[model samples]
Target: MSSARRHILIALDMHSATDAGLSTLVSIARRLDATLSGLYIEDSQLMSAAGLPFSTEINYLSAEERILDPEELLRINRLASAQARHLLEELSARDKLECTFAVESGKVAIQSLSIQGCDVFLPGRSRKSLTRKQVTLQLRQLVLIYENSGIFERMLEVARLLAANGMVSDITIVSETPLPAEITGKLSIEDVRWHFQAVSSTRPEQLRALRLNSASLVLMPKDLLTNLTERQWFELLEQLPFPLLLMD
Candidate 1:
């Protein structure tokens, strides 16, 4: 592990509901002395389908017009960009961490794929098909979830308290497959070395077996929880002897 600052990217939608995810990113960034980048992707396809035309002029037409003028599109883009900047600025003020913002027009997954050199992607907890597809495709990428809102500071404090108590040791990064060489290479450079391990078994029984064999905390991104029924997640939580940290 190296001492380089961690680079965290938080996927933003500018919705009030995403505060939890944003806070999580802020907390981690502050604790690690990391840089936090906020990302907001404007779904161009959705805008187009909604009758907004991506043109160069603002055409104020009736609802029947069915197309957005270039001016209208530009206005909307500007608003989104301002919202993203405000979110990052607020988080930076609260967490006292270095922060930046990026607003892009494209599909979220495609935009995320193009982002390079990020330590982790922290996304809000939503049952969106696009989110699922993106996470599935980027299986090797490290991800954290924002499970709920209004607890960013608490989460950071918890992480720090855990570290002090020696509870944040021997982390197991679970997945159904091995991580790509590129991701592993980056993880290798992280300075806070804890016996970083992984379990590729997808079956519940297999995961339980592995848990019994190691005395490490089990960590999984919250997005993965959406794929499982509430009962299933609860069962795993109850059955697993070790503490489970859900990064949302």
Candidate 2:
């Protein structure tokens, strides 16, 4: 790892901005001697819809329809952002790390990828559409998405760091091939519990089989998603019920 300071950016949404995720990021920041920051995205789609006279909202429980007030949405956005900032501040203070946060108006992924200086960008998970239960962040089962590239090492390094801070019982690499002996040997010597799951390919379906609830963190290389269109990118995220550590 470089001795120079790095910046870690976390993208936040209303449903998934939990303290557990923020604490994990703060721990990583402490390990890397990096600064921490957050981006709270106000959904552009909802905001635009509010401008239309026909836009209305239905209560999921009450089945009642009402006009979608832009003011109400803006108020909700500000409240969410403030709550996120409060969580970050509380963790940063407890960890003795400097942290900051901001609000952005756009799609979460687009706004997240637009920022260039962050060494690690965590694209926040929106509320999952699937009926499966969501898992809280646990650093024990570290999961890394493998690409035949140099980014795996970086992913492993971050995973190991999390292991050191938390009780990481096992590390799993989702790759088509086994890791090089050099890396595997080090893990063995360190007595770290680890395993590999072989896949025929890195197709979306194969990747999706490794469900989000079982792992503590999913380390995905940005290059693997470089070819994904905006819609495709969102589809992948929607399936993930946990925070995704997007490695650049």
By summed lDDT, which 10 consecutive residues of candidate 2 come out lowest?
A: 128-137
lDDT tens digits, residue span 201-220, model 1:
54444446663311233344
Task: Tell me the TM-score of model 1.
Answer: 0.46
How many clashes does the backbone of model 2 have?
0
Query: How many angstroms is residue 106 displaced in model 2 relative to the true structure, after the best TM-score fit?
Result: 1.2
Alpha-carbon lDDT, every model: 0.47, 0.70
User: For residues 166-242, what per-residue lDDT tens digits would candidate 2 score against the true structure?
Assistant: 54667888877777877665564154678888877766535567765633667777666556677886677656655
Off by over 4 Å in 1: 14-17, 52-81, 126-248
Best by lDDT: 2
The runs of at least 3 residues in candidate 2 whose Cα sits more than 4 Å from the true structure, single-residue gaps closed, are 56-67, 121-137, 189-191, 203-207
lDDT of 1: 0.47
